[model samples]
Target: MHFIEMQATARAVRAKYAQVESERYGRPWTAEEIMLGFLGDVGDLAKLVQGKAGVRPRDDLDNALAHELADCLWAVLTLADTYGVDLEAAFADTMHALTQHLDDVRRSP
Candidate 1:
C-alpha cells in the first residue's frame, strides 16, 4: 500500500490502542507517553539491527527486523498524526533538500 494508506492503517491501530489504554489506565496515552513508548521501540530496533549485522545474537533476524521496522513506521505515522504534521510533504521536502545538497557538493572542487 501507499504512504497514505499505510498512515491511515497506523492511525486506526493507534485509535484501537487508545481505547485499550483508556480501559486499562483510565485515559488514553498522552503524546509524551506515546513518545516514550516509541523510544523504547527504537531501543529494541537498535538491538535487532545489531543482530542483523552479526554483532548480536538473534534467531529469525529477518522476521524480527521486518517486524521492528513496521513497528517503528507505525510509531512515526502515529506521532505525525498526533502532532498534526504533514509528514508526507515534510519527507518530500527533506529529500529534495538533501538531493540538492548532494548535487552541489558533487559540483565542488
Candidate 2:
C-alpha cells in the first residue's frame, strides 16, 4: 500500500492500542512509552536481520523478520504522526538531497 494508506492504518491501530492500554493501566501510553516500545522492536529487528544474514540462529526467521519490520514501520508512522511531522515530504526531501549528493560525487571522480 501507499505510505499515506499505511500511516492511516497505523494511526487506527495506535488508537486501538491506546484504548486497550487505558483500560488495563488507567492511562494511554505516552509518546515516550511508545518510543521505548519502538526501541524494543528495533532490537528485535536487528536480531532478525542477523538471523537472515546467517550471523545468528532463529527458528521463526521469515515470519519474525516480517513481523518486526511491520512493528518498526508502525512505530515510525505513529511517532511521526504524534510529532506532527510530514513524513512524506521529509522523506522526499531527504532522498532528493541524497541523490544529488551521490550524483555530485560520481561526477567528481
lDDT by residue for model 1 (1-109), tens: 9999999999999999999999999999999998998999899999998997889877788898899889989989999999998999999999999999999999999
Model 2, residue 30: distance off in Å is 0.9
Please identify model 2 stretches exceeding 4 Å from their true place.
Answer: none
Q: Mark the 10 consecutive residues where model 1 has the least summed lDDT.
A: 52-61
Off by over 4 Å in 1: none
Q: Backbone collision count in every prediction?
A: 0, 0
Task: Report the lDDT tens digits of candidate 2 across residue range 1-109.
Answer: 9998999999999999999999999999999999999999999999989998999877989999999999998999999999999999999999999999999999995
Pick the lDDT winner: 2
Among these predicted structures, which one has the highest TM-score?
Answer: 1
TM-score of model 1 vs. true structure: 0.96
What number of backbone clashes does candidate 2 have, counting pairs of residues 3 or more apart or in separate chains? 0
